[model samples]
Target: ERSGASMAQPETTRVFLNNVDSYASRHIAQVTFEACTDSVKAAALISDVEAELVSNHKRTFQVVGTVSHPSAVERPHRLDRDELLSKLMGCDVVIYNVTQHADQVEEALWAASALHSEVEHFSGPKMFILISTIMTWACSKPADPDDLELPFTDAIFWSRRAHPNFERHIDLEKRVVKMGKTVSLQLFSTYVVAAGLQYGMGEQIFHYFFKKSWLGEDGPVFGDGENIVPTIHIHDLASVVCSVIQHQPRPYYLLAVDDSNNTMEEIVKKIASVLGPGKIQKKPSEDAFLTKDLTDSLLVSLRMEAAYIKKLFSFNWVCQFGLVENIEVVVQEYRQSRGLLPVRLCVLGPPAVGKTTVSKKICEYYRLHHVTVKGTVSDTIARLVSSLLSPPNQSELSTLNRNMNPAGLEEELLLNVMRDELMTHPCKNQGYVLEDFPQTREQAKELFDGKEEDLSCVATEFVLCLEATEAFLLDRVLNLPESRVQEHNCEPENFSRRLAAYNEKQSEDDVVLNYFYEHDIIPLQFGNPNAEADCLPLMQKVIDMVGQPRNYGPSSQEVKEEERRKAGERLRREAQERAEVEQMEADEARARAARWAEWTKKLEQVRQQEEEELEATSRPMRGYLMEQVVPTLSQGLTACCRAQPQDPVDFLAEYLLKNNPFEA
Candidate 1:
């Protein structure tokens, strides 16, 4: 009868998980909300709990998440204190996590204080749970002083002490419990869950070590590396949060850690072996790249176990055996979460078949490097020549100086150079597009030979062959512009010779096609006469043949950074354009003003010259009038007045006639 009812019906439980903005809180909220839902796969760590709990009641979560830094503009996820309180009042179970951020400890205490103050006017039985960290017990004294290896468990949680740096967390935990005791008369209760160091989904505290290992660097270990750092997968930690929300166990303090007691050295070595070149370097505690809090957490020597969870909960163990034991799944999560996989490709084609063009397009679209013979040969020879300057290769330098043609070196040396280029960091990380390489079957074999069971890291995922008919190739060469013809050596005679060489069939045993066929890799043949006319369709076909990308696109953080960069570029361009226009306008106005000023000065000089000329011509006439005309007219008039007779008129006329200035 009990079994029948367990499978008979389903119910819903509204749960509130706060601080969803944090790394730990986000995982807990996601697991609690999605534990029994049909939309998402129930967390693997809580499969047993899911089977038991979903059989009776389903859970729905009201998650409150906020950004770490406050924004000037309002955001939907950034809730205020009143808004947070309102969300808290509506849910049956409220979970506030103080594990990730120190500030969250204050938030948890505030929630508890608010609950205690409002317990008298309660609506329903509300349980307030605080998710904390095992670091709080980093300095705890073991119950048995004689047994130094005694493991700390939740049964002895009362005797646990905090590290000197984590007193604030311990104080907050105590206050939360005190507040819960004050609300005993009402339907209110509190629980403090101390979780182990979390690892998974790219990680938080262990991210520095994970990234260094992934980059194939020497993983750094602090101090002697013998400290036992207890760890739990974030999924498992979330499962513990789910279990607490559902069961509401009797204990107020619960220790959440895995079964494994692996030391720091064991964990670092395991990570390096799985992802890196299996190298580790020990450094002083002060040399670690992690923040002070994380460094302290990483160097912690406390050993802890989830004794209460093991005895009371029925969840399946996801990394409950611990991180080093389940390194593969954790490493996969790390790679996929960060999008750090490479997608290598090789392109093959006859001359004038658009091999370089298509390879460049593919590299641009996929964020890959275009590796070609010309570039690789030049770079490799340059590096070899540069290396010759060192004392270790002095003999090689002398030999190279004697021979100008480094390209004439043995085939083995060239092959090694190409192999080295293929193994470069960019090719291993972002990926590479090899263009027109391995022309012969023997060359392909030498470059790509790998072990019997495993492929080399530089092996190509796909091979593309571009082909065209002889008639099409001939016509295309004829239609090429003079510059293009000269640049590619595609004149009629040269083009025909190259085409014939490309078409000549190889012996059955020595064909390059046979090499690929034997390896079960069929070359994708793409032949389109109009491919050069429009390249998008060809690119699309190639993309379809390749299928989904092996590596992920830009991450969210990268996208935001790119957006900011584009915005800055646009603003800079606009400012430059505005400045140019303003300068041009200023120059035009100055030019016009200068021209007007010059014209006005020239007009003033012309007017002054005309005035001076007029004065010089009129000055002689004025002097003659004053010196001759006035005296002559005065003598004539005096004679006429004295005569006063008929002959006087004739006398005055004779006197004036003889009185001309020049004649006198």
Candidate 2:
């Protein structure tokens, strides 16, 4: 490295400028180059520096022109590749600041190469200085033999091979040197190392670990205790980058600032201390590190050395704060950011009374994630029907018979399925927004019976009691889409009839806070043809109310018990009414049976009397004819012939014989 009086001046002689708010300001002449314009972080840092320079230095700098690239913004008659090259034909120095990715690096190199080639064409030796990161090198892992080759071979190869020992700055250094250009690489280790955990993009590990307490009291640890981590403050990292650009180092530089290195155990212990002391158990060596997948690339042990860069840059940034100092801050901030209040809210309402929609709006307004129950009456019914009719096979016949029999079987099946699904769903951990569930008063009773304690806690913390008019509900039911109608296995024409029955059974007074009026629970009034937007503000208000903190109030257990008592009373009345109806039906059936028995007995007696009369008449006729008719007739005829007188007796006998007709 060359070291002499030239050190007093800024090493590099070129500057890149970006986002000049007002062009008329002092301290601008020194700003020959603009900060990288592509990145949000870079842009923000430059803005801050620009503001500071304008406020304090009051200096103005001239803009030679702006660099043009395909990715940059568009303009009329914008400089083409040839024009851009012509402009930089004899520039003595060039500055590069962009992402540290392999492709980005390659693009930067190409741009610099173009500038240098043009300068050489015009008879000037160009000096180039590049600013980048080592993380990019670590990100470049070798591709598997089976992996397909990408278009940029050099970028792919470098990104893959560069890891624990490879410095991102070193790679840039190697590339610049190969191109015969001066390059300086600046590397910062672990930017923004806070004493406490912070939540950023993706599934934040801290939130995962603390919110769910995945690690219990003790956090996770990986590998042997020999891994070293170099940490830096984000502010420090930005300052160093700016400093390097200002000073313009000769060949290359690496920046790292941290008070000391602590093992994973030490960090975990510090977190535990802030969280209050607890059992800090270590996983057995046989146990594979649980976070291996998450921390594999970013782990300190598997990382390259930041010490060389730290020495070269001579940056004095420090991580003076320990875990205890900021652990609470981090934890509180994470909780606030996630809207994870201690309170739990459970909204109760009739089907299609806007429970789900309201719950969603509440969650959105409060920045809380809302979870819902997996199944409902309609969903369960659909599943049952699907199962019964599936495959169109012999088995389906038996299933159908079992499911569709008896009038009330459908409702029963739906209740059972809903209960099972709710219990099994993943959202049970975070509670849920229930819709079109707890169909019957009995079902609701059963739901809260054994789990009264839990239910009470949930209700007290967050409970919204909902109700609506019968007429409004009837209209809603009628206009429901064909999908919903089919899902419940109901016809559209039958909607009014079904809703009437539902209302009769589970009357509003039975389920709502006041069967007649609204209470503390958010009340949503909807008319015919409900519009979701009409009620969004009310829903949002309820959500905001539930999220606010309150003084220690009544035990959720007590509130739940009161609800349970009321539910039990409602169920008892229903059971009594059901028993009375069953008894009346039995009595009616017995009266019908008695009437039928009386009619059958009278018909039997009539048939017996007719048989007896026929037998009596036949026996008397036979005796009279046999004993008297033959002898009397013979004697009378002989006497009448002897006398030969008035045939009165003969005529009488003939008449009697003709009239009697018992001749057989």
Candidate 3:
């Protein structure tokens, strides 16, 4: 304690925080530099954000905001390019906050490029570009969207062109490296880095929850909120930045998010819970286009691991708070910010593509409510039975009885059943597979009726289209064993005709696929010429494709209680449904019988009409005179021709004698 070499005065280090000043100050000590932003950085100062901003060459830091200016992209007039470049040149580190104005990516990159040009050798400042997870998702796409499931890593997102805003990172990296080996460059693969109660996702979350109230918002959740986004608190982001600053991470890009692998649904639900009880309006990603583009960075989902960065710099999260644990902080911030949040798909495939089986696996993997159209009808019937039984409407209920004619009412019943299934709980609140229903485009269009007063909001998030060869599908559809066969046997000819009809139905469904695709719900085709592999690959792919949802949903006890409540009621309802289905069968039989009888009558009528027409077209025969010529004609005409030409009369007489031309 007494060794007073008069501890050398703490040399102030200049660390540029860009728009991140609010969140970075706590983690870094005294730092010097102005943080230019479109809007003032939320929690830019005196907020809860905390992170260390230290580097190898510098220790103490002083972050001072001296310059006030407009967004360089919008108000280039406000920014004195020369003065800004001078200020940048004086700084030891340049952090370009590209997150605020996506339109300013080029401006930021240009600023970095200018800074790189001004400095060289041992003088160049280290640069960091902060980017979001959507950049990564866009980058991950190949010429073919369907390939192996890949992770959103720093390396991939840094250079990819899925987004132009993200291209700034690539440009900066190239520019910095071009400054020769002395300079360093980094692109941060960030998820939702909380800025403050007012900035970044905090404001969005705040508004989203507040507006949602208890009924939930009218906005849609992207891709059924299945895509996982690696997230971090603002303080964590600053700490990550500071850690990178200190270590001077090299070889370019690094992931900046922590281990909070939350889905949009999870985050929204958590925010909802924190704010107080409320509902989350979940819809398919395709539906998001009603508000946003398919490639909108905020809407794209990216699950990343900061593996390389973590290992390279011994980086770890300094501030620990997660989805559940950070509730208090989130609530406080949300309230402070006046609460908001930008809220956050489908098995569709061709015939015999293991759609149903894959859908089951997808629901299983995601722990969603797996239901089919038929099952939904049963559920609806069960619900209907319960609804009708409590009041005991024997008369009207009998109208729904077996004798009510199922065929005539099936479409109407299904419309109601599907409406309930799609718009009510279980299927409504959670995910479900629509099978064997909406097989045609018209039916699908009916399901999402534009004219309906109360529309169905939720639909299949993903369509797992299973494909197999014609031979395989036919064999599977037709190869029922003799023992398993029934009265109206499926003969080869019938199978051919049915297959042709099936193809025609598929052709009709082309419009359905086109419609869904326009809504960004394209069919994911997985094909197997031979169905020998027992449906395992299809299931695996479904699981792989249907990214895991964050941990939430009805707990085991809740599900059990629901099951218990439905069981007793389901029995009576099942009986009613059975009766209704049987009636449908009977009605269908009668329809067929009627059609057959009408066809028979038409056939007889056609026969009679044809006979009358034939009689009308008939004429008297010139037969009596020609009858004597039969025997003469039967004798070879060639012989008559070959015989020596006789005198016309003598030849006629000889022919008449042989052929009996003269009938008495």
- The lDDT leader among the candidates is 1
Measured with C-alpha atoms, the lDDT of residue 125 in candidate 2 is 35
- lDDT against the true structure, per candidate, is 0.74, 0.43, 0.50
Q: Write the residue-wise lDDT of candidate 2 on 528-576 in tens digits.
A: 3133548665655564665553212333676799899989999998999
Show the lowest summed lDDT stretch of 10 residues, model 3: 1-10
Estimate, for each residue in 56-165, the C-alpha lDDT of model 1 and write its tens digit: 34434555445564452266655778987887777667787777778777777887888778776666767788887787898888768898788999877777788887
C-alpha root-mean-square deviation, candidate 2: 26.4
Per-residue lDDT of candidate 3, residues 144-180 (tens digit): 3574344555544444454454565455445544443
Assess the local accuracy of residue 422 in candidate 1 as a C-alpha lDDT between 0 and 100. 81
Q: Model 2 Cα displacement at 387 (Å)?
A: 44
Best candidate, TM-score: 1
Candidates in order, TM-scores: namely 0.66, 0.35, 0.39
Worst 10 residues of 1 by lDDT: 1-10
Better of 1 and 3 by lDDT: 1
